[model samples]
Target chain A: MDRILYGDNQFFAVNHISDAKSMEQSMKFKENDAIIATLDQAIEAGIDTFMCTTHDRIAFVCDAVRSNPEKYKDFKIYPCMPYAHKYANAVTELGIQGTIKQYVPGNFFGSMFKGGKALVSKDYLAIMELLVDAEMKMFEGVKTPVVFLQNVITDLLLGLGMDEILKGFHDYVREKYDVEPGFITMNLPKLAETLEGLGIENPIICASINSANFRMSGGKELYEETLRTKKIRVIAMQVLGGGAIPPKEALGYVCGLPNIESILFGASSKRNIDNTVSTIHEFDSK
Target chain B: MLRVALVGAGKMGLSHLSILGAHPNVEVVGVCDTSLIVMGALKKYTKFPCYKKFTKMLDQEKPDAVFVAVPTKLHYEMIKELLDRKIHVFAEKPFCLNPEQGSELARLAEEHNLVNQVGYHNKFIGTFKEVKRIIESGALGEIYHFTGEAYGPVVTKKKDSTWRSNPADGGGCLMDYASHVIDLLNHLISPVASAEGTLLKSIYSQHVDDAVYSLLKLESGETGVLSVNWSDDTYRKMSTSVSITGTEGKIISDASELKVFVKKEGALDGYTKGWNVKYVTQLTDQVDFYLRGEEYSAQIDYFVNAALKKGPNDINTFKSAARTDNAIALIKNNSKTKA
Candidate 1:
């Protein structure tokens, strides 16, 4: 894992604080060129990894990075799967069969055949892998060292008591993509325990890790206890506690924690990005 | 532990089942769905009993409470049956396609003295919850104007026919999308008394409206605007927000954050004369089981606790949802009158 990973929530209209700011960011990154410029600023600030969701617009970002190999030679993208809202909207508008026809990869006739068979047998793992392959097509030939399961599906599976699907995703991604598999969740402690129970040890998990325990399901102590005794590498996210805690205090809390291998953050401005990097560096130096 | 069962294994149903299945105070006895595929998967994967028919499941499992997550067209029959059996019930939002059926069911629940709730999960969101609290504190004194808006990318392109394009299924921007905003308005501010200058526009659907625009008058004699569009591809997901202006201050909030601007220094406690911003992180409480968002699990836990304590049917009750349903009726009627 990189010491610092840039996120893509700001590129999309996802803001935890205000919708007005989100609309402003949506206009600011309306074109791929603007998003590439921001990525360049992150690279100039010494961050090398971009952890992003597999939204349709991200395909353009991947194209820009793949075409300019020299400029982004060492840049890596940590792709997160299923892009949630894509499937949600598709399912609502297109229904199940139509959604499969629209999103399942490979030849149309072949996907239809396999989709029907998968639906018949209720082979959820098969459908999951097909969707994973569909979502991963954009990242082809790009440097992707790690793939993450988005928290929507991760937390759903955790609550559903379907630990096998989590294991299935991990094994398939590792065997096919040959990259480390990661899971993002709101409840880090339960997911760590669930993974360990499935005989999978030392997994990579990213979650909200702040002193305020904002969106930290089950609270802060369980997460801290898990980090102290568990054998999992963590990527601390939402370190600013949904923009409530100040950056210095937020970074201080996260960087001082044990077992946190990296911090993931997204910012729309160069000044904010540079400030976060310096704050992390300052805390690390101590 | 309270014995619980769920009907309809669709998207929202599955989300509710996942949360309730892990709840400490609940024991999931049976799950009934029309899809044999979903039932078979649940029976194979989890320990809960699965059934094909709701009536059969009700007879065999005899649960103390039931969660009705079927389409709006099916809510009346399912919830009525549950209330008749003296079982507590929690039904999904836009409670029923017909407002009269919703009111009758609300009356039935009250007559039977059973715990009844309609799921309007936004009320449990911290930022929006804070919006209600601030308004109640008179922080925004003499509330004069408000706006409730929501947009999403649900119907960005034309596709084959589904339940969304069917009015009988309680589908469209008004029932499916705008109802959320209207419910929030009723909960946080005042219930809408009338609507005029209404426009229901169809962007991509042939049979249903994709956008809803209307001018609303609250029962308190104040007015506001209701603007909602589900065909907006600019937004990645559903973004619903509320803004209120008053004599002393103003407030703007979505599910994740809250913003307030006061005119005086001592207008509200902990709020300066200038703008004060608050995030959901500090305002939200922890949930035992989380999926999609904290609001989902929080609402379920609230219902469970309410049932356990035999508390008043005050929050998100069928009565409240029926109020929202009445507001939807007013909007539809206003559109017809204008046309």
Candidate 2:
């Protein structure tokens, strides 16, 4: 993960605080051009890493990057898998089989047989691999050094005690795609403990770490303690608590934390991107 | 005896379970479902070990064959792993959601030399089997046109919440109902070479089609029409019928009976063919135990026996199912372009 990774919440209508803002953002980014322009703005401001979900439209963004490889040579993407809404909508539109056909790359019949056999044999890890492949399909030939499991599935698997799958994903990504695997979760402390128990030392975890503790699960104190002690690379997200906290104060609070390797934020305009980047630089210098 | 297990405890899963469990040559090893409620219900019918996680079941039971009736979305990966494990699989139709997946699975099954079958139970229906026999015999010489109709009351109202109403889950009348018609058409006539004049209408579901109509041209040069509506509430129950017209005669067949008419004698077996009706009861095989439809059991039995190398591996193989998938892809593409 980069020191300042651009987030995709603004590209998709994902607002933790307001439905109105989410709807507004959804309308604004309805066109791929708008998303591309914003991404270009982020790149112009020296933010090279674009951490994003595998939304259907992200395929267009991946194409944009691939088309002008020279311009985005230093750029990178951290793809998150099982974009729940995408799969849900695809299921509603294409049906499961059709959804797999549309999303999963490779020969259709071969993939279908693969999918069918995985399901029958209860080889869910293989299914997860298929999904990961499906999500990463668009990023072929693009620079993607890290792949993150979205918190939606990460937390669900956590709750389900599916540690094997979590570890399996890490191993698969490293062995097959040759990328570092990252996990986003609401409960950082528990995740750290879980990863360490699985012998995954110094795991990279992205979670909410802020002054107000707005969306930070297990409270701010616990996250602080884990950051101070755990052998993990922490990526601070939602530092502004969905814009409840001021930017400078939020950046100051998170930047002052120990072992904070990255800060991920989303902004729709160049001005916001510029200000956030400058603020982080100022804090880093101090 | 062949050891078998089942994943998915839904309607189809239970159907497969009942037949597999009762079969004389099968030993039901395990049943797995994500839902405890579903697995709990399954426990009443069989004392086999139940599991919420499929991998656990597979690891513990290690069955020689597995029957999968999970959502269509889950077919590809599941089928792939089963093939890798060398476990013969009997999957529910449509074999896959798309042509690519269907073809891939077909290829893998052939490569692995595995006995793979899709749940196109209509093929096993007595009337349908007789219809296929008549067509293969060329009783209806120079077949020129055919029509297929399937109607039911599965989605008469808004069904936005269920997987069947969702396209990703392989929901909608087109994939669910029209697929059967397409398979039957492929069996009786020939693989659909081109499909046109498609109408995919949604009466109750916003995502998937509730009614589907299409014009098809088979590779055998036979023209056909398919009309299927899951939203139609007037039908007393689900009804699917096919009528084929040829140079010498015509035949109309449904689940219950097959009616044939011939202009010349000796056109079909044991029939002068002025107008003859053969009820399903008269044509069906005598079975010791049955549920839902004998065709369902027949398909399962065929797969198991095929897996045991006692029968020919010719029961709706993935290759055959891929043809239906191709027809579906064509219909869907045509409908989208027109829309």
Task: Name the best candidate (by TM-score).
Answer: 1
Q: What is every candidate's C-alpha DockQ against the true complex, given to 2 decimals?
A: 0.53, 0.01
Q: Write the per-residue lDDT of candidate 2 for residues B139-238, one digit (tens) a residue.
A: 8889988999998767766647667877988888888889999999998789988878899998988988999998999997889899999787554346
TM-score of the second chain, each candidate in turn, equals: 0.98, 0.97
Sequence-dependent TM-score of model 2: 0.55
Model 2 per-residue lDDT tens digits across residues A18-110: 434665887898899999999999999999999998877889988999899899999999998868665544554445455666666566446
Worst 10 residues of 1 chain B by lDDT: B34-43
lDDT of 1 by residue, B110-169 (tens): 999888888899999988988888899987889889999999888888754888788889
Error at A152, model 1, angstroms: 0.3
Interface RMSD of 1: 2.5
lDDT of 1 at B6: 94
